[model samples]
Target: MLWLRSIIYYFLTALIALAISAIAGTVWGVAFALCVVSIACLFHIFNLHRLHRWLENPQVDNVPGSFMLWQEVFDQIYAEVRKQKKAKERLAGTLDRFLSAAEALPDGVVILDDNDRIEWCNPASCEHLSLNRKLDMGQPITHLLRYPSLRDYLKQQDFSHPVIIRITRPAEQTLSAQIVPFDSTRKLLLSRDITQLERVQTVHRDFVANVSHELRTPLTVVGGFIETMIDMPSSDAATRETHLQLMYEQTQRMQRLVEDLLTLSKLESGAQVREEEVDIPQLMQLLRTEANGLSQGRHTVEIGRLDRPRLIGNHDELHSALGNLVSNAIRYTPPGGTITIGWEKRDDTACFTCRDTGIGIAPEHIPRLTERFYRVDRGRSRNTGGTGLGLAIVKHILHRHQAQMIITSDLGKGSEFAVKFPQARVIE
Candidate 1:
């Protein structure tokens, strides 16, 4: 419409020029019309130049202003420019949000270009691959993580399976990495820290093997005693009685093992224990008596002062946990060793501690003491009539009661097993 108006104005100007030429001289009128047309063209050219300059470096405040057709043209171009700027801003915002979400993820994320160059990576990826995010940009992925397995996996583009890499630098860690191809050339490399998962799997395998071995020992003894009784049916009564007694002991051992296994299972299954106010003084007295009975004069069992008399937790579970600790102290302590049971509050935390002058655990073995069937000395553990699940049971019970078992020991000196209940569970 602006162009049509401009064209109409030019036609009218020509008509006026023709009328002037008819009255005055054609040369003067025609020159005047040419001058007017030249001036209009120059004005349009000047506006176009300004628009071009603004397009080269667009700023919101520097939009060109013009008149007539040129004005319309400048306005249209400026509006389109503003629309494009908004679209770009929206796209940038979305990209920022996507990057933020990726950064927040626990798993490592790396983006690679067609050349396998590092385009972007999250913090977790940096830790997993040990890559410097600032310096490693545009560096080849293979250059940073130079493991043969990762290089081969990327080269083959076989993303069907994730590759596990064990890293020894910085720390011993296991990472599972997989690459996914997108947009033909771009790839998303994802990695997860699987160290804990691997440890759990190893523990599972050990538990199964240990269970089989533990069950087999008692079953073998029972089987041997039964065979002896059958073979010596015609022998003297004294021999038969000895065979029967041996068989009963083996059966009892088997029973104890099965019971411990069941208890561990129940605890692991997250079964909630009954909460009751337990008398710590009474509990300690009972444990002292039981410990003395188990010690059979071999160890000096003593019940110390109980600072917190009542505890809000499962009485039975507490009994079992403290009993296991006391029993362990007695079993490991040699003759005339002192074993003390007591409760004390340290900084609002109630602790039920069993300290003994027994043969203390080695530093390295203490970490794995709570594992099922884990024993520092298998022969000694068996001779002591331990099922090897006592500590494990104690650990789970403490967990249920919102408590923790802290074991401190010095090799050949003594060990102290302290069950520290949280402040909330301690009743004064």
Candidate 2:
């Protein structure tokens, strides 16, 4: 373009000079030809100026007149700018919400980069693991977690199986942690407090041991009695009566143990925890009838002002729970000792209180009486044909129904066993 402009400038200058020379010579044809050439050169310069302006030469002028002519192009660029700004804000808001949710979670969460470095963590993870931004940021995951399982898991690269670690951190906290491999080459650590679950397991193990030990003694006694009877001569009638009576009593004791065990098994298995309504008054009446049969008109049962207590539970199962308490009263209370069965409502709940004026449980023994096959006095319990699983079954039944069991006792006065159920839990 420069070369062309230079040639045009030289041609225009030569033509203007030639036109002046022709006009000075007064030659009509030559002068007219020169004048037309000069006019054409001026027009070419004007056309070149317009062509340069149309090419949008940025070096030409900062403010060109095309802003009005190209208004649509300017508007599109403005719209695109606004769209990009809004998109940036939206992305920022989304990220904020994501971080907020992560912080709100109760469990700990840590995100790692491909290099196994701590990249991000929520507040819970921070508190659980004492994460220091200055020390932990861009640091190794091993440095923070400090657990063998995590180290081994990282070493093996076996993401298919998550490494679960039980971590004890600040504030006497016990946590069960699981490292889950998910999207993005990072590991997620989730943890929950399992102290209660651990405690319950320990209690269950102790109960099993105690029950085994308790049942073993009675079994050994029964076996010895049988062996001695076999060793005795068959013709000894006087000895036979005494041995036979002892064996019968042992057999009855064994039967009670087996029955109590079955009752406990049924209650624990929860074959009857489903929503069911029980007429509380009717259930007490039934328990009374069973107690009468056990007493054989020996003990007098004094029932309290029995209000028709309507509760939501299994009638037969509740009957069995109450029956155990009432029968225990009859067996422990002397033939003349009186037993009282009371039904009432406490708070927003219905309670069945069995108060027996029998040999009450001691304070120290009351706590463990609900343990399977646990007896306060083994010899006395055996003499009374007690299985020791009675209170345990009662406790399990109350547990299944989300009810509470309260046992109050004194040395020689009496004992009261009350099963309380919240009203909201009651069924029609």
User: By TM-score, who's the top model here?
Assistant: 1
lDDT of 2 at 404: 90
lDDT of 2 at 326: 91
Query: All candidates' TM-scores?
Result: 0.84, 0.57
lDDT top scorer: 1
What is the C-alpha RMSD, rounded to one decimal, of candidate 1? 3.4
Instruction: Give the 10-residue window scoring lowest on summed lDDT in candidate 2.
Output: 60-69
Output the lDDT of residue 47, model 1. Answer: 80
lDDT of 2 by residue, 95-134 (tens): 9998999889888888777777888877777766667755
The parts of candidate 2 lying over 4 Å away from their true place are 1-192, 233-235, 272-286, 292-300, 309-313, 331-336, 344-350, 358-371, 374-383, 398-404, 410-412, 420-428
Global local distance difference test of model 1: 0.89
lDDT of 1 by residue, 271-383 (tens): 87679899998888899889889988888898776785589988888899889988888888989999998898889788888899988999999999998888999999998
Q: Candidate 1's error at 379, in angstroms? A: 1.6
Q: How good is model 1 by TM-score?
A: 0.84
